[model samples]
Target: MENNTQTTIFGLRAIIEAIESGSTINKVYLQKGLRGDIFYQLDKLIKINKITTSMVPVEKLDRLSKNKNHQGAVAQISPIEFHDLEKLIEETTNQNTIPLFLLLDQISDVRNFGAIIRTAECTGVHGIIIQQNGSAPVNAETIKTSAGAAFKVPICKVNHIKDALFLLQAEGIKTVAATEKTEDSVYDIDLNQPLAIIMGSEHRGINPSVLKMVDYKAKLPLLGAIESLNVSVACGVLLYESVRQRL
Candidate 1:
């Protein structure tokens, strides 16, 4: 991650906003299934909001905290501000932008996110969209992993990725998902067209909901022993192919 990226966000009000705003939070450490109105509200919100959570003992919270009465909870926020999908798309179109966009469905690794941003910037991707929850925070580690590319690229966080995809499709931009199950290599596809490439979490691949909505699902040819490439590397492969075709 980059040196300037934020690693910790404390205080009760800060934690509440991080949860409610759908920021890319890696995890929430609570004081071990705590019982109280505030704690209970946080817990209820955590479950209802679908934020990844961990109930840790007080000792663990102590280690994570500054030892200054943390009220049984702490939340970590990424340094970067998440972009809005519709706004980004609209801005590009209204500006007559020749756009290349990337959509990530639940990728949780900061390093991978950083790497992909580096690659996206290199390939001229207009922006990258990630789900606010279940995605990696743009912490110091992510910025460092991206080798400073995270700052150069625009990142958008959304509550539901399906709606984002639908909006893109409505704008005449082809939505493509990279999946191993497909027979077509990205090379076989036409990247010259205005397109949005979708990648999934390293473990799950693209979400089933997002995958079904894609205009086309393409896969990279696996000619070697390795079953697959890392999501970031796979993204580079697919994206550069688009760049190649466009050139």
Candidate 2:
């Protein structure tokens, strides 16, 4: 599997230039204990822009940069541009159709994220909101897994999941979380209305704090021994329920 398809730019100055040029960076890999004037400048720029960074050994930097002179830092450029959550919400609300959105909390697997995006597109999801840090990067594998649906869907990256929830709630969109903690079945929820469905990470279900903020907590009826479904599969079920209700 192609793990990463993002273009890599090495050197601190080059990364700084890319940031200044408004390039969308997936993440930056920096060498451990690298202290220099240029590195400090790049670090400041990364923080100011709230770009994600990882401190790795020099070996990783070399591999990421194809054994080139990475200058103790390497940055990966995102393939697709991200959308603004507030602006996307406004646009969706202006349209004649009811707005349907998806919020993913810390979905770190690229393939799962890709599958969810494809399903979201099919279900007429207006947009997808994910946190900046724990979410999977949109790489070649993800796009391929999405069958090119990645380009069709508008995705937004926020500082925190709660930030997106607050904006959606303020706009009168009800938030629903998929979890086993609630007794309500997904079918019972009113999905025809403008709504945003939240799916938690693979291992851990929706964050407890996030569950408290949602307008509704629902779960799929599990008849078998398995207590939970895959995050992507559960998302499809919820989105299609919304589609069914609207029909």
Q: Pick by lDDT: which candidate is best?
A: 2
TM-score of candidate 2 versus the correct structure, residues matched by position:
0.96
In model 1, state the lDDT of residue 231: 90
What are the lDDT scores of the predictions, listed in order? Answer: 0.81, 0.92
- RMSD, one per candidate, in order: 2.9, 2.6
88-121 in candidate 1: lDDT tens per residue? 8887766655678999998888889888988988
Question: Which regions of candidate 1 are displaced past 4 Å?
Answer: 1-3, 13-27, 41-52
Clash totals, every prediction: 7, 0
Query: lDDT by residue for model 2 over 108-223, one digit each (tens)?
Result: 99999999999999999999999999889987778888888888899999999999999999999999999999899999999999899999999997888999899999999999
* Candidate of highest TM-score: 2
TM-score of each: 0.87, 0.96
Count of clashes in candidate 2: 0
Candidate 2, 14: how far from true, in Å?
0.8
